[model samples]
Target: MSKSLLNHILLLVLLFIGIILSLSLGSVSIPFKEIIKSLLALSVENSTWDYIIVNYRLPKTITAILIGSGLAVSGLLMQTLFRNPLAGPYVLGLSSGASLGVAFLIMGAGLLSGILGEFIFSKWAIILAASGGSLLVMLAVLSTAQRVKDTMTLLIIGLMVASLTSAVVSVLAYFSNSDDLQLYIFWSFGSLGNLSWQEVGILASCWFIGLGFAIFCLKNLNALLLGENYAKSMGVELKSNRILIIVSTSILAGSATAFAGPIAFVGLAVPHLVRQLIPTNDHRILLPSVILGGAILMLICDVIAQLPGNENTLPINAVTSIFGAPVVIWLLLRKRKLNF
Candidate 1:
């Protein structure tokens, strides 16, 4: 077998193990045997164990997988589209836009209730707000992309747009009641455990469609890596591909922030981490490799955040940056140059 194929198979094994470990090692620490039994709908000895597995852990596990892979793929697209080693999904400011959306819902919902009604108070409301905010930013960026010739110039516009949105969120927070402020703070810390199956289904749908865009653009992505002029020579439609890339990024990054509350480092770190293993610029290989690598890393982080036997858990957002930042630094230092 080819070496890359062997590596992929190994990664698949690791992914399976990560999923089971995430299921088994939460605060209550269910046994692996019981986890398997519960998953198959056979009763565990304790009803609470079954309840916890079905209601909490399963949805959470599925969420981690989606958030991890989706964010990583979004990062890959950004990195390739801009051809910048430092480029990431957040560079486009979709996260900030999503944050602004959720901030309005959480901090300003009461003021808008008479005008917009109670729709802002629903569970799905947060997701919609975030998506709507992201859509607005996406439209602005798309408009800028059309006017700007240089990709770097377009990236700069995205940064400015992101900054404006972030400032607005901060202003909203300053006027918010303490209770609302606290709710926003906890949401920013990020959570993978509270999603219902229905929320997961919505997140999963967004993830699927976002990935479909990335998959469709794989050829253009690889061609664009060398240069846009080169890609043009190769018959890649620059404008259409650019839209696909941005829209895919908006969907993935936006939905992830919406559901999971702004996970840090995963989108930026996972693609680089995969490059350290697979050593490829080809999106076809990098996409799947990064997807699995992202899911595995997220699962690992989730396992640590659960704090095993302890009742208290670390904030997942902090845990990701804590664990992932060091690894990324070490990898870059050892390599002495980023792959891309």
Candidate 2:
């Protein structure tokens, strides 16, 4: 088999292994046999065991897969759109926007004498607030992008936006009471286990909408890989492509942040890793690889976060950053130059 096919098979295998490990080896340590039996409805000692499998582990596992795939693909699209290897979902301040929104709600409620806290703390309210923040930032970026053709300029603008929002978040954080501060800090760390089936369904819907948009942009993405001028020569509609990319990326990154918080590095690291492994610039090949590679890494991260055989789980963001930051540094050091 060709290298791509072999690599694809390898990723699938790793994904399967990761799933099995995620399901079987948490604090309670359900046996692999029991896990399989529970999944297949063969047998279960009690309803609680089934609840552990179906209600908790299954939803968490699905969240990991979806968040991973969505963020990685968003990063790929951003990098391609900007032709910058370092560009990612966070690069455009999208996640920062989500963070700012959550900060506003949590902190604002805390300062309001607990009157609106109940309403603001609702799951849908949080998700909606985050989505709105992300969409607002996306619009700002797209508007600025219209005036700036240089990718580096666009990147700098995004950084400025991130800084601005971060400063606002800091101000909110400083003024907030200890309880609200703790809540915001915990959410910022990221979590995959808090989602329920209904929340997961909403996330899945947003993910599919974003992924569908990305699929529609595949040809334009491939063309733009050569450069905007070349892509324009090839009949790619630059303006339209940018709008669609912004919309898709907003949904993907926004929804993930809303549900799982701002997951770091999966977006930044996964695409580069896929490119290194597959050695292809074609979006057709790269997109699926991006999804699989993302899911695999996320599963591993989630498993590690669980601290198997123990009750304490690390934050998903910390695990991803610890694992991803080194790969990025090594990649940059070895190449001595960014392809973009």
Q: Per-residue lDDT tens digits of candidate 2, residues 169-256?
A: 9999999889989988998999999799999999999999999999999999999978889989989888888889878988898899
lDDT of all predictions = 0.90, 0.88
Clashing pairs in 2: none
lDDT of 1 by residue, 139-168 (tens): 899988877878889888888988999999
- Every model's TM-score: 0.96, 0.94
Q: What is the lDDT of candidate 2?
A: 0.88
Candidate 1 deviant stretches above 4 angstroms? 115-119
